[model samples]
Target: MAFDWSVEQIAAAPSITPPTLHKHYFRERKPRAEVRFRVEAKLFTVLMTETEARNVSTIDKYVKHFERHDACVPKSA
Candidate 1:
């Protein structure tokens, strides 16, 4: 599954800042339960509306995948 939403867009739906989402994306820190729930809720809503399919498990899979990946740092030129 793929989403066209950017970090900013995803964060906007949950009222989270882009930097916070970036931190999560890069595995800088684990997201708090409240933040994680909000993001999951947003994803659930969008996926249900767009595909008319229930995808909570799929969302969880991707979230866990990111958390398990090696930490990333932004590259500088």
Candidate 2:
């Protein structure tokens, strides 16, 4: 007999991994923009892991949130 799938089971699978402290050390100097983006992404990844909310929609929300608020201030040329 085949096992039947349930709504609860499918919904429970949020595809979230536990937040592991990922520290990347850079020996050489790098561009400010690149470094800033990496740091932001890493922090976002950690938060997602902790919350167990890894869906694309949720991630997109965080990215937008950063762009609107937490991200670096733009410098007018």
Candidate 3:
């Protein structure tokens, strides 16, 4: 979904410093695994609170896009 949160708000949710998030996540640097998890968790929390069908779909799209090229780390055998 199109979030109403500003960069400051988004950064706040994941406990990331605004400047770091802007330079990393917003500026196209791939976030570290921990940062990615926190951000995705925040988005998932938002998705859980959404009730509209269309908005849920939109949020799903955002999650997928965020996860692009970043598969789950494989378990050690």
lDDT of 2 by residue, 24-49 (tens): 22332255556567777787677778
Best by lDDT: 3
1-77 per-residue lDDT for model 1 (tens digits):
01324567778977999888777656533444445566668865766665556566776676665555324312330
Q: What local distance difference test score does each model get?
A: 0.58, 0.48, 0.62
- Per-candidate count of clashing residue pairs (backbone under 3 Å): 0, 0, 2
Model 1 regions lying over 4 Å from their true place: 1-31, 53-77
Clashes of 1: 0
- Candidate 2, superposed: residue stretches over 4 Å from native: 1-27, 53-74
Look at candidate 1 and tell me the lDDT of residue 60.
67
Ranking by TM-score: 3, 2, 1
Error (Å) of candidate 3 at residue 75 is 11
Candidate 1, residue 60: how far the Cα is off, in Å? 12
- Score residue 72 of candidate 3 by CA lDDT: 43
Residue 30 of model 1 has an lDDT of 46
Instruction: Please report, as a residue range, the 10-residue window in candidate 1 with the lowest summed lDDT.
Output: 68-77
TM-scores, all candidates, are: 0.30, 0.35, 0.38
Give RMSD to native, each candidate.
Answer: 11.3, 18.1, 10.3
Supply the TM-score for candidate 1.
Answer: 0.30
